[model samples]
Target: MDDKKLVKTLFMVMTHRNEQVGLSLWNDNPQGYNQYCQWQTIIANPRAMGLGKRYIESDLNRSFNIPNPRTYEEKRA
Candidate 1:
């Protein structure tokens, strides 16, 4: 089977660490879960999640494409 065919949807669970709705969807529905070959949950900021904060140094959402990454979030980006 084509690798592409296995993933019907790419669920990108970004930003909020406390949010488990996306993971719950992946776990609750076995039939739907099978459609995705890869782990669907994409946690954008592990540091923020670990710290129980929205971000460490800077807002991750706005840190992307930064030339000189000075902050933790910027470095992650």
Candidate 2:
């Protein structure tokens, strides 16, 4: 018999690439950053952030429901 506790992973998705709040939060707290290493954090639109825009083709926040996924944001979804 195996008895072990499972820790559920936290998924922090940066839907809006233009927002730097999360980055600031992580940078401000070293302890939080250490804990964050165990969680899944995804920068949904890296290209959008690089280009200084909210998104490239479409908004990633709404792209998750896309069926065909034609645009870059849709593909990212």
Q: List TM-score per model, in order.
A: 0.57, 0.65
True-structure lDDT of candidate 1: 0.65
Best by TM-score: 2
Candidate 2: pairs in clash: none
6-66 in candidate 2: lDDT tens per residue? 3334444455766776765444442322322434455667788788888899888788878
Candidate 1 clashing pairs, residues 3+ apart or interchain: none
- Relative to the true structure, candidate 1 reaches a TM of 0.57
Cα lDDT, model 2, residue 13? 41
lDDT of 1 by residue, 1-77 (tens): 56767755455443656665565554554334444464444566777677777677788779889998899878877
Clash totals, every prediction: 0, 0
